[model samples]
Target chain A: MGVIFLHTLNRMRGTMLGWGLSLAGVAILFMTFFEDIATQADTLKRLMQSYPPEVLALFGAIQDLSTPQGFLGMYFFSSMPLILGIFAVLAGSGLLLQDEEEGVLDLLLAHPIDRAQLFLGRLLGMMVVTAGILAIAFAGIALSTQWAGIDTAIVELAKSFITLYVQLFFLSAFSLMLSLLMPGRSTAAMTSGLLLFVAYFINSLSSEVESLRQAARFTPMHYYQGAQAIGEPLDWGSLLGLLGLGLVFLAVAWWRWRARDIRITGEGAWSWRGLLVRSRGSSA
Target chain B: MRSIEGNAKTLDDPMQIPAIEIKGLTKSYGRVQALRGVDLEVRQVEIFGFLGPNGAGKTTAIRCMLDLIRPDGGELRVLGMDPRRQSVEVRERTGYLPGELSLYPNLTARGMLRLLNSLRRHRADPATIESLAERLALDLDTPIKNLSKGNKQKAGLLQALMHRPELLILDEPTLGLDPLMQKEVLQILREARAAGTTVFFSSHNISEVEEVADRVGIIRKGRVVEVLEPESLWDRSLRRVRVRFRKAVDPQRVAEAPGVTLLDGSDGTSVVLQVTGEMGGLIRVLAQLPVRDLETERPTLEEIFLALYRNDEED
Candidate 1:
């Protein structure tokens, strides 16, 4: 288990650097713009009001657009799930299929480790990276708010970041589950990534169309942001639901992987839309 | 229908634990059956060669012994332990180099081996790793993705050989290696065998198997067809001898000779003979015939192996 975790962490070192820099970089960049926006708060507030109601959904229904946390939440936290979801899904999908595709899973499995250890070890590695990347984002926002002369509570912003981590964790767990069950890497990645996009899209659309209001409850994105958790309390119901479902998915992934015969290639390439779309018997 | 027998470890008992034992093993993926009733036993401290072409279930049979894949039916034991129920225990004493080898692309060869070592119950000695790296001439510091195909294979072999387990299971160990490197690897296997490691290796290269294997098992389409000592195989082997006569020779005369059977009617002045016994009598007989050109081609190990597969196909 230690080896699997270390090996997987080594593989994702470059990814952690890339995503960490970009996401945190974007957060800092947005905060730097906040000071300028705060001065012209009146003009920006009027402009935001002039836009359509659907456009306000972009800021996650934040009423006070003039404040620093409001601006950061609108720009950074709202789209956090979108970016982190894909990253987590890729990590989860890669936890198995990456080694499977490269044909190294056979080498790893030849050790005195159980199939459960393989899944758990790699999952632990991905989870650690997720936490580190999220911490970077959280730190970047907390400090940038200070440098920008904002009076927002650091603890409150940290709370919002926690929710963001939960959302990404759910996506990652679901993706790992799909990777175990699906026939190919791209199938798992694309399916989970596509689900994230559709869920986010539906959550946004639920704001306008009252029909999708209750329907949005079924989407993973629904539990992600508790209206940015700016001043309001954390939604414990959504939090538990996301955490619960993630564990369930991981459990299923383990059971399926432990019981099944793993094929290195072919038979699962034909994703709804993915790389190497071929039918069965293509492994030869 | 087979079940395992318990072994008693006592000084008086003198127990013999076979490295691997399989009885009526069967496995299938979906509708495609990869292994069908494979029954084999590899003795401890013995080198057993498994021969078959690609997709002939060599990999599947080896995996079952390691319990990497569950067999649909049959019983398997490795080192006197049931592989299915005690896979981790079975694997702890085995070293495996897969047919399709892959290492961590991001990590250097040294780092990859370190990771594998950390996970193992028995740690590979640093001296052993260094010596094996030197012997294989593998650069431990280089990232595996940057290495050439042969180099990567050498690295894979290093990881397998580094630990020096009791049982070494290699599938096409020399698959991507050059002839020179392949020879080096075969020498390593020989050395390992001398050190008392049981080698259960599968290869399509007949000569490689012929050179190192004490006994060879020929598997075709997931079934073990034949398991025999290499010496016995050579004893019954026939050599094709072509004798070109200076003058037209009587086909009946060559056919009537001892230890010689006419393959085909004398091709013009040349008689193609299949010789089974000592070449001395056949050569003396050919000498009596005004032989212009003489050539004898021994049946290659590959030809012998394929003959078994071909015979199965015909049936």
Candidate 2:
């Protein structure tokens, strides 16, 4: 298990470096404009008020445009989940499926290690990589806050990044589980990507569109802190619930993969029709 | 044909357990049955060759023994342990080379091997790996994606032999090698057997198996049709003889000879006969005829294999 974990981490070093630098660069870019936005705060506030309520609802009620939290929240934090979620979904779905599709999993599984150990080792490795990238991005945000002389507590920034980390972890876990049940990695990634978009839109539009309010509660986006974490206390119930759901998905993926047949490349793609037919025949 | 069960009981040490024992094993993919009641026993410390043509369930049976694929019914034991219940232990003592080998293309051969070695309880000796690579003529620094098919096959063989397991199961181990490398691989297998490793390999190459395997098992249509010594196959294979007589003679004389069949008597001076086993009887019969010239052709291993399968179907 330790060997597999270490090997997984080593293999993912390139992904860590690439995504890490890109996210940090984006954070720095976002921070540089904070002072300019603050100087025109009065003019922008009047301009924002002139727009319809529906338009304002999309960015989430801008309470105080002049504050650093409000400025960052409106522009940066609103799209952070979707930005990080792309990496999460792709990595989670590809972690095992890539090897399986490339035909290397059979050789790896032939070793003395059991399936459970391999699953958990790779999962832990991915979680660490996710955390590492998030930390790099946070460091950029912190250094930029000091440079710009923004008045926000460092602890509050840490809290917001923690919420972001948990959100990305949950999406990753969900995608991993779907990869086992779906036909292939692309299908799993596409489904998860579509769900992420839909959830974000539903949650963002719920304030203005009353009909979507109830459905918005069911999406993972509903529990996300977004800009709220920068000023308010942490929401323990939502944080823990997302964390617990991620565990459940991980557990289910492990159960299915332990006994599932590791397929050869180009043998056949697993599909719902084939599964259902087999199920019916067995039941009959 | 000698039965595997009978051979198992006649081993030098009666108390010695077989390296692999499969009973009434069966597997299916959707509607296609891959294995049907496959019963085989491979004794310890011998080179056992499994011979079967394409789609004959050779890979499927090998996969079941290693617990790579679950059998629909029946039982399998590897190294005296149940594969399903103690798979990790079974794997710990066994080394396998998959039929279609796949490796991490991004990693160099050395790096990939190190990763595999780390998975086992006892790591392979670096000296042993270096020697195996030298013997196989494989470049350790080359990435797998850059290696040729034959080189990739050499890499696969090195990993399987590096750990020195008690039992080795290789499926088509020499598929893409040059003739010289194939011979080298056979020598390696012989050396492994000398060190008391039970070698169970599957291949459709008859002469290769005939040269190295102590015993050979023939599988057809998901069943073990025969298990016998390789020498026995040579004994049963047919040989063709053609003779030119100095004068006209009756073809019936040669037809009545033991193990000889008169295939052609078109001209008055020539006769063609197919002989099975020894040619002693035909030679004696020919001495009486007015012979001028004689020629004979040996049967190929492929022809012998087809004959065996055809005989099995007849039975």
- TM-scores for all candidates: the values are 0.89, 0.86
Evaluate residue B171 in candidate 2 and report its C-alpha lDDT on the 0 to 100 scale: 94
Please report how far candidate 1 places residue B89 from its true position, in Å: 1.5
lDDT per residue as tens, model 2, B108-137: 999989999999854577878888899899
Q: Native-contact fraction for each model?
A: 0.82, 0.67
Every model's DockQ = 0.63, 0.57
Mind giving the per-residue lDDT tens digits that candidate 2 earns over A131-200?
Answer: 9888888888889888888888989988888888899999999999999888888989999999998998
Choose the strongest candidate by DockQ: 1
**Stretches of candidate 1 exceeding 4 Å from the true structure:** A55-59, A265-284, B1-15, B236-284, B290-306, B309-311
RMSD of each: 5.4, 5.6
Q: Could you tell me the TM-score of chain A in candidate 1? A: 0.89
| Docking quality class, candidate 1 | medium
Q: Which residue pairs show backbone clashes in model 2?
A: none
Give the per-residue lDDT digits (tens) of candidate 1, residues A97-182.
Answer: 78778788888888889887888788898988888887877778778878877888988887887788888889999998998788
Query: Clashes in candidate 2: how many?
Result: 0
